[model samples]
Target: MAVAIVRNVRPWGGAAADVVIDGTRIREVRPASPAAAGTDGESVDGRGLLALPGFVNAHAHVDKSWWGRPWVPYGGEPTTQGRIAHERAERGPLGLPSVDGATAVLREFLRHGTTATRTHVDVDLGVGLRGIEVVREAVDRLDGAVDVEIVAFPQDGVMRRPGVLDLLDAAAAAGAASIGGLDPAGIDRDPVAQLDGLFAIAERRGVGLDIHLHDRGELGAFQFELIIDRTLRAGLQGRVTISHGFALGELPEPRRLELLDRFAEAGISWATVAPPATAPLPWREMAARGIGIGLGTDGIRDLWSPFGDGDMLGIALGFARLHGARTDGDLTAAVALASAQASPFVHRDLHDLAAGAPADLVLLDAENVPDALVRGPRRALVIAGGRVVARDGDVLL
Candidate 1:
């Protein structure tokens, strides 16, 4: 391990300090006023900049980065809209090639100081997770530049896809971080059975679980209960997650509290994507009650939303715009969902330039943390495993 100190750096917009990077760890962080005596490797004058922990996009779908060419319909929306448009595309014979779609989007994420990202790639009908193969290749190509984890996501109904569970296993074999599935309702209106099978696949294969439940109206807690229950019973409790369970829409106050209490017990992490746009503030209330809310990009550049810029700055802005975190503390919790407090889920020591933590951090141009999200990912610097992978608005890979 070697030492490289950054002087005059403000982490989390606090006072100036020297951040020591020793090997792949943030060795020690201290106030810089006294002019610390020890020096070895190199000293970078981190003047007028904020040092931040790398933004870990707990969720994303990089394959759809260029779905909108201003011509085709959209992606990952309500099936009706897509089906209707599919006919139109079939008739008009228009399509967006997946290979060329995701190029610039990856660069955009790096420029915005996103060092690590976990993306869900679809393995549904007609779509064979081919894009995942491309993503894996791209991630390898961009290996040192950015950290990208691929999840074999069954964007559509899992059971509906022939051999979907098997394919999920294959995705795991291909190094997907977890196995993913969509609403149980769409696959046969039987959320439990399909979810049970999916979780079984996870336990048997020893993989993590990331499920999407946009069908809140129909599935509701019935689906979530299954994920929670299976995760607990299999002793894989904290290894699972539930995404977009928005159907908890304005959950009755009593039920909301009770459900959150149970959710905390189950140790299931919540994924917040498209928060401002989706709504139902009981979510914030739930988080306050000890529920873990991990942030994700959901989809980057899809047809339905057309807005994901692959930069988590947009995710935070979208959240703050809708949620209104009045105080710095409130904003702290909101941003914490993006990283820290994941605890037993992911990135054990994900935030802060804390010692003994993975050296994933950002150098921001913004005045403060919350201000960074609002002001846009500014003058970003990304460091991963103690290596300066990205800077000066360039994608090394």
Candidate 2:
């Protein structure tokens, strides 16, 4: 753990600094000086490289991520409901996405500097927990290369999908990281009962919670309130997340402010995937109010979404475009959303370059992060847990 000076390095900001690392921990960052010392240790030449906290993808579906699927590319040219309908029809019944497909997707993320990701796994009935287990194993196989957090998700209703909750239990027992529920409305005729059951299981298990909200229009009202109450009762707001709560920004102005204010107060964070089609993603308002925000690819290279390239930069760029915000601060905030800070669920200390933090990191081939993200650099060297699992454009290869 002696001094290792990485000189003339471009830290997250554009300013070049002389960074000193004591073993894997970054000891100091200061303006470059002639007297900066480099000791006999691993030397990382930072010239022509950008040093930033490795990117974190707050939300993603790795197993369901498909490439070359029969889906139109993101942003339909027609830009109307009819066009969207036609696009869906063309894609046909979506093929079952698998862990094999996810390998390529994981490499793509690492290749672009996203070293950490929270992936939701499909725990539907017919498939059992095999798909999620497969994904978990793949991520475990990449343990030294990239950080992937798996969520045991019941895409089918927890109550309606007989034995699904039991499957979730088994997943947790089998080392699946978190518990997830999707649209309790899909669970049964009784929405409240379904969600209550799921939350009860989560409460008993002491696992993190991530919920997908598909309630469109008026139906979301009851579902949202119940979710908030359940999270409150669980007393794990710090460990809970709500993905795609799009309707939050769609309510009447006063109502929107009230609920979001509550969301902020509750220690809850929202996962902004498609940027809320109902309203501009509430970026400015949420940050100003201290609400934790994060970004996700949602569905990568799939019929559900063709926008993802397994890159967090793409996720942040989409956020910037959809929200109409631009500034270094905005980019910084966007980066946090893609990092561990984005979710209340993940417990990793992943936002800083420091000693003792796992060497889960990314190196970008650019001058600095803001500009690098703007260029969407493809050259990335990813180190996960002290091993160079991804390098030379074939991260995890």
Candidate 3:
């Protein structure tokens, strides 16, 4: 039975059409049939709003946020190690990594039209997979309205922290889609050992690796090579991602091009939050080389920093402004990176406003894709898995 019909909407700013949903997938999308729209189980008149696939948050830290609580001042130091220590010291007292906190962050995501996300949950000696459990319970609390993929992340140094590798392995065995590493050389000071340990676990457990590489310039590039080598060695191609690889943009053109080729060869993908003042990525070249790029909001209102709101469109806009996107094509590409192009990041084979795709979409009152990308107006409605989960910027679920 058809669950719903979204009437008279412009998909990607195309001609008006009615999107029919059956079960959890789109059944069909054909020319607008206003008369037939009245027969739907749940009929939503789109009012010719511009429709887009539900936003995909490729990289996030849902477990770390303290949303829905009173504002906590940023008390962590500026450096990564300092922030990690601060979080470990302070999170316990604040009841961090609770289901409520994670749920709060996810609800904010849904309210902003994000239907799916790939979030990294901290897996350190202190937390000991408790964060993962919190995130899982939060997802269950939502009852599948938001699809979440977990990456058991070693936010603290993987190699330096004893027993963390075993925890990561345990997480992989317990159904974590991917295991994460953080700054192998900068934090662990042993890039080779850290990468080798992570690769060994990934190969053994048949899981993917999403490593955070914050070491800038040559140091970062060196680790990238090490990761590339290990990715091919372990036959983990197409299952490895480098998150916040700031070095890629900092390198000279030739060096950057060389690494891009190697990254393509290793089937490595990238996830970034597009922080300001950083070098702009060679996104055109990466796109040409078929390298996948995923955008994320990182962490929001956490012990790390008191920023972000879990809005993927705002992150897309930040990416556009950072990359100097001015033309219609570039602007639309930015939005696509936040939606359809990010499908792979969330393990979706396809995610768009078309037949056979998951019935997850957002409707905004805008003229076109570029307009939506630039302004990022409030979502008029959000359909997730054929159900109206949010409307008029309010999360129904």
| Backbone collisions counted per model | 3, 4, 0
Give lDDT for model 1. Answer: 0.67
Question: In candidate 3, what are the lDDT values of residues 126-179, reduced to their tens digit?
Answer: 889999999999999988889999999999888898999999999999999999
Residue 6 of model 3, lDDT score: 87
> On a 0 to 1 TM-score scale, where does candidate 2 land against the true structure?
0.83
**Which consecutive 10 residues in model 1 have the weakest lDDT in total?**
88-97
Residues 1-397 of candidate 2 have per-residue lDDT tens digits of 1235556666665576666555455566677766534434455455536766667777888886566444545544543233334334543344454555677677777777777778888776666787776676666665535567888887656776679888888777777677887777743556787777667777777777788775664576567777778778878676677888766766777877777777776677777675535566566787778777777877777645666687787777777767765787776666656664653435675456555554555667775556766777765556554445566677545
C-alpha lDDT score of every prediction, in listed order:
0.67, 0.67, 0.92
Model 3 alpha-carbon miss at residue 303, Å? 0.5
Of candidates 3 and 2, the better by TM-score: 3
Winning model by lDDT: 3
lDDT of 3 at 217: 95
Query: How far does residue 244 in candidate 1 sit from its true spot (Å)?
Result: 1.0
Residues 164-207, candidate 1: write the lDDT tens digits. 77778887877677888777775446777687878777877788
Off by over 4 Å in 2: 1-6, 18-41, 67-97, 186-189, 275-278, 343-345, 365-368
Per-model C-alpha RMSD: 3.7, 4.7, 1.3
Which pairs clash (backbone N, Cα, C closer than 3 Å) in model 2?
Answer: 25-355, 56-338, 294-337, 390-395
